[model samples]
Target: MVTLEQSQPKAGERAYAQLLDEIQSGALPAGTVLAEMEQAARLHVSRTPLREALRRLVADGLVVQQSPRVTVVAPIDAHDIRALFEMRRALEESAARIAAERGDAARFAALADELTAARLDGETGRDAYYDLISRFDVELDRAVANDYIASALRTVRAHLVRVRRMARDRPERLTASVAEHLLIARALAARDGDLAAHATHVHLHNALASILANLENEGSA
Candidate 1:
């Protein structure tokens, strides 16, 4: 996981980013208690800004305030994963259809080429692969040209970042995911709306299965 840097001018945003990074990276795992005084000191910010940061995280569903002073990271389980994917499937499938119809073919084709060339043989490659996916997401949102869908996708991506970390240790899943994304990228490049949507559906299905299996394995271990 990338280290989050502190921003002196915007303490609240910096705290929020740092905490969010820690939460997503499992450095601050689910159900970990976040005390105001402790976290404020730990994050090296004032209580007021730390409180603001915690409130933002609360709104993001990454943290929950149990009382005036007690806050904890939200739990991640089968139910949460399932619900998240259900919405992801709906939103992404629709986005794929619209993007295929209106998106930049050359851009998606370039992305497909990038995926095809991605090695994923080492940490640097893996980081590059994830960055490629981020670029693809940006292109999709741009192609769809819908503010509402983009906003909703941002929300889903936030949760997905945490879930994705759970499966990152699996090399097999990582390879398969790259292949799956290549297919979706190709379908989008071809401007085949149905094919693009179907490819996205399949990718999400495989992704969810991999994530759940990883979670179960960790639980058993």
Candidate 2:
């Protein structure tokens, strides 16, 4: 739900952010052509800033240049989802282990309590829950204190927004994810690196399975 503000400074950045949000949210779905003039007008930016934004999206693998004049949103499929999860499993498991060993225990403890009490009944509740998860990710990144890992994670997370949206309708999976995250948080609070890593592994495993299943169901339908 990122709004495009015409008055924002750094017009390229503003255009990029708005376009990225639209692509990730499926507002601009796969194969949607991004005509320079059309997008420039819609986003209230000039051609130069629009091109800059498109170039950035291309670099992020969220858009593809169909031709010199045509850029379209990239298609995501089951194989792509699996590849994304492979990277997530590696980076997140390592991050959880490192965070458990060196992160602030009280902070994770508080996060675990919040996860325990999280409500996911409605859209607002789900938004709040996701916001809490974002907080947890921030804390985990801070605890690891590794610029390289954090940078890699930032890239992985950009694509993950679309993956998460795909599963938004699955309340069961969402509920399970909260429990899985709670386990990892508690392990971190206890300073149990091995347990935290194992929990992360399990969580990723379950998530990949659920997402693949949903994808298959969609294809059949």
Candidate 3:
């Protein structure tokens, strides 16, 4: 006896998903005020559900409560990006090392081939490239098999979407990233934990450098 209400997502959950997507996609850019009544209307939800959604976003650090009645999207700057990379480096490096030792070598070898042949020319190609990376991440997570580290990585990845959008225009960085990922995948395929870890570190270092440089360029522009 499953009722429609039970089968469908709750209003709060739906609102939260929509708001989270908008925030991450920059549709609701940082520092944009989230008025209760207005957002409820815009999202077509009641005030209570919208409040529930806002609370979740606050916990996620995607929004900030300015007062009892005011909330705004969180701002990301160079400092925030650096802190994010600091956490990412710690988590991803360890994950790569563990996965290299325990993961399916054949699967990683296939991923290495995919990375080697990836195309990132236009917007469509870029989307496909990102999809390939997502698949690689899925495999890495499955190989690592650590809930705690995976949970932390999920949080870091949420913010990373916004950060990635900032540097999406830099074709050079994208090209280098493909090479970096190829090295990591090859290391994992070879079951070389040290090499996987070191490759992950270098990849993160280069990625952070490129992102920061892009931010500086934008600021100067």
What is candidate 3's lDDT per residue for 118-140, written digit by digit as tens? 99989998999989998999999
Question: Rank by lDDT, descending?
Answer: 2, 3, 1
Q: Residue by residue across 1-221, what tens digits does model 1's lDDT show? A: 43233443388888999999999889999999998899989999988789889988998899989888789999989999999999999999999999999999999999999998998878898889889999999999999999999999988898899999878878999999999888888989999999999999999999999999988888899
Whichever of 1 and 2 has more TM-score, that candidate is: 2
Best by TM-score: 2
Q: What TM-score would each prediction reach against the true structure?
A: 0.93, 0.95, 0.94
Clashes of each: 0, 0, 0
Give, for candidate 1, the lowest lDDT window spanning 10 residues. 1-10
What C-alpha lDDT values do all the predictions have? 0.91, 0.94, 0.93
Instruction: Report the backbone clash tally of model 2.
Output: 0
Q: What's model 1's lDDT at 31? A: 92
